[model samples]
Target: MLASRFGAAAVAIMCAASAPAFADDTLKKLGQFQSTGAPGEIPQVEQGGKKAENLRAIAPKIKVPDGFKVELYAIVPDARHMAVGTNVGVVFVGTRKTKAWAVTDRDGDDVADEVKEFAPSIKKSNPNGMCFTPDGFLYMAEHNRVLLFPAAEFFYESPDVAVEVIAEQLIPKAEESFNHGARACVVGPDDKLYIPLGQPFNVPPKDKLPLYDEQGMSGIIRMDRDGKNREVFALGVRNSVGLAFNPKNGELWFTDNQVDGMGDDIPPGELNRATKAGQNFGFPWYGGGMVRTKEYQGEQPPADAVKPEIEFAAHAADLGMRFYTGEQFPEKYRGGIFVAEHGSWNRKKPVGARIMFVTLKADGSADKAEVFADGWLDDKTGRYLGRPVDVAVALDGSLLVSDDLSGAIWRISYKD
Candidate 1:
């Protein structure tokens, strides 16, 4: 397919031609993605009854393409759409409501035991972005800063303390209307931290019909590992609560929440690929590649504005994303991306609440999208059995999902 698109010889030539620019652009996007502290992971969780915290039984019933099986990998308490990490073989996850971090060791044998907490509490702050670096140090992203603790101290409290503040004092003041407190961060290819500082509110235009640009308070920011070198990569983005580096192209991808109160199906949510730094993605000016309605008149972006890779249904509230790199799934999905739809609240009718896949083409556009897992939200009564927040690859080549609504972790694997 790639050869057909770019030609057999053109692949090499084009790669050579684009390599330098791609690398430079990739570095900029990486810094932009991690400018905050650490980006969070979303787990697509079931919304039914208050189920028991068991990783084994929760794995099944997840719908997937052929040749795939789902199972419970680990059970976590109050698991939000935050990040997770593994070292040697231990798996760790961060949470928000409980202000705690948990870990489980799932070796290649498909068994996860020794469930425990890595960090106790952060006191009045949300716990997100618990991940590892190319080095061995484990990192966690709180609301306004990133904290690092020794890996050995994960099992037991260690007297050897090495806590460093990578990023601090973010967005001292924001628009009074926005509800964006979910800032996620990750390390970029340049070894610097990229963090997302979200916008302030769900705004409307000045007068009413034909939406206009409502700028300020919402954008993707970049910073160094030590919290220096801060800059805005793109503006007008409402909020990218989750971010992930595309394993195939090394580009940064994010899920943006469309502004609400625009009806259930207008101005759908978006899955955006950050191809260049300082690229403006249509936010208040436009949504889902179409102009939206607003209360006040505003300036619209030029026709040259970058469009989204994929536009989800209105109010889907797409969040965390993970590129599938496991061996358990079929070959077709080996290099695809999985996104978690946390569902929406302000809409008259709720949408999302499932795990979906973005099938990428050689040109990097999403050719099509389909649900990898469903049964989360009910269409008949508008009730939800589960709410998916983030997706992650487990040690055994299975997929793990976190549910903030139910505070549970689910595992989906293949067995054929």
Candidate 2:
């Protein structure tokens, strides 16, 4: 049939092109899809019931400022990052697993009415980071590839939809790792896709620096929306799961998870700022906040390595961050920042499992970092009730936070 549709020569050429893709499981899985679905074919995610009630039960435990309130928004399994669509009021969530979900509120209520797997026809890998462009294109950043779904909000109901491959094989197969596999992507002011390619090691050897730098693996790279003309935007990053662009000045600010194992309270996490291209944020050399790593202690870092705007507590595991551009909150929250501290993993005493609110000065400089919401971590027993992953502003000016532990999304809004 293919030969009849595209001539004998064209079919031969296409077969040769696709022959290599079958060799890799990652790309092979992506090819398993259907243009349509059978009876009861599409997978559906239950929206409410016990799982949601449990999340609501934990809501009162979540403490917020006096004027603010927290409530259950949706029950999404393994929800990691969220992207709100333009005009449709649908929120697309990505997970570290294979599923990405589309959360909807059909009755104009604050709570979600439906939660379903998005584009279930196509298989996926770790689609953890995602963001939407203003023009209705949803970009999903997998561990090693990026996929573009146009009109995602409107076409989410169908299992089959148009999907475009923005980039294939972001890194070599040999370089892929389960550690630090979460990649963050955002559309910059210049309409370029800025994505961070994390290093696979806690502290890599010195000999690998040049190769990693050339591959843009240990840095943030920006490419044209069509995945052309890619260049490294920043270097020396350890692993940054969060990326946000300040609206006022168009500068990029990100949260970097510093090197671990130094001690519980030694190297600190960082929230960095980037104003231009080719800038380096100290990594391997300085694990976090000027503390040199043992691996590269004998070596010197770049003299122009940029320091962080705010240094968070060690092992806080700061992940996704976003600028507060909504108006439903108090005036103080306007033009501010909201970052999710995923909490400490190996720390003797757990430090964070909360949402941090950062204030900006009149000149758009970050001034302070304070906990806007907490109670996710039990101080006495060191138990985690929930771990917040990412934060996004809803269309109604509220904040939607994704929690992988609870497999749910929570909404924070101001009532007073």
Candidate 3:
């Protein structure tokens, strides 16, 4: 029944729409059948309605520093990375699931007035990365392709907005893995589109090292807006899901989820900085800086393998991050980094499920890291109420955090 509906709906929509004929193949492949149903038909792991009501009941329990308050901004299923629309004040959210959402607040109220799917006509697989170029173009990086929606903020509600494939065949269709396939993208200060391609293994298999290194897998790559001049910008990273360019120095910063199965506390997750192009951050050779993995224990690390700027708690699962350039917060938060730790699944005692702040010194080096907001994980019950996946600063200077577990976006604001 699910496949029938999916296939019929897809065929009908394709026939009614003006999209290219090749989109049929893409939609068919994305609809690969499973025992449960079509992959796209799988209900979002987190949902709205009853789940959202429960989440709202716990919203007041969330903890933040003094003078700060947390409120439910919107209910968006499977919200991952977020990009705020420049002209329309719409917050665009990407997801590992089929749909991407655009959230809006038409009135002056901080809460959202409407949350709707963006570009329902387009078929996307693991469209987890979303960003807006400085010139206002919105780009979405999916598992195997990248898309550009020109003037997306203006025409998101329309069913016939133009969609261009900027890049495709990013990872070979045959080599696609169920794990670490969701990507993250950012428009860097250089005006290039930067994307991180995670190698598919806890520690990449030795047999695949050459192919991974040559193709910039397990690292970050950049290309022009037209998808030309593709080149490896950084290498030797392990499943980095977050990328942010500092507004002050334009350097790249990211969160690297370290290898698992090494006990709860052996290797730590990392928050790293890359000051220049072609630099490598140690991965298989040294898992999360200095903790050698058994797979590559005897191997030698690259001479220039850079270390992380700060080491987070092991199994924290640090994912999305951003540099705070907003003025709504206190003066002390200016130029600091806000990271979303999505929490842990395998640990005996789960950690993270909160936001962290990392302050930078005058010299542009990290000074300290501390929790900015928490209480998502109840200490008494050891269960998580929400898992934060991404952070974004709204145009009004408020901080927005996307929680995938609870299917909600939270607004963190400050008042004197």
> By lDDT, who's the top model here?
2
TM-score of 1: 0.78
Which scores greater on TM-score, model 2 or model 3?
A: 2
Of candidates 3 and 1, the better by TM-score: 3
Compose the digit string of candidate 3's lDDT tens values, residues 65-140.
9999998888888889999987768998999998888888889699887787876667789999999886566899
- Model 1: runs farther than 4 Å from truth? 1-61, 106-111, 121-124, 150-161, 173-178, 204-216, 293-297
lDDT, each prediction: 0.61, 0.85, 0.83
TM for every model, in the order presented, reads 0.78, 0.91, 0.88
Candidate 3, overall lDDT? 0.83
Clashes of 1: 44
Candidate 1 lDDT over 205-271, as tens digits, reads 3352122122223567776655567777766576787787776776888888877776767887888
Output candidate 3 Cα RMSD: 7.4
At residue 308, candidate 1 shows an lDDT of: 82
Per-residue alpha-carbon lDDT of model 2 for 93-113, expressed as tens digits?
999999999999999889998
Highest TM-score against the true fold, candidate: 2
Backbone clashes in model 2, listed as residue pairs: none
- Each candidate: how many clashes? 44, 0, 0
Residue ranges of candidate 2 with Cα displaced over 4 Å: 1-40
Alpha-carbon deviation at 91 in model 3, angstroms: 0.6
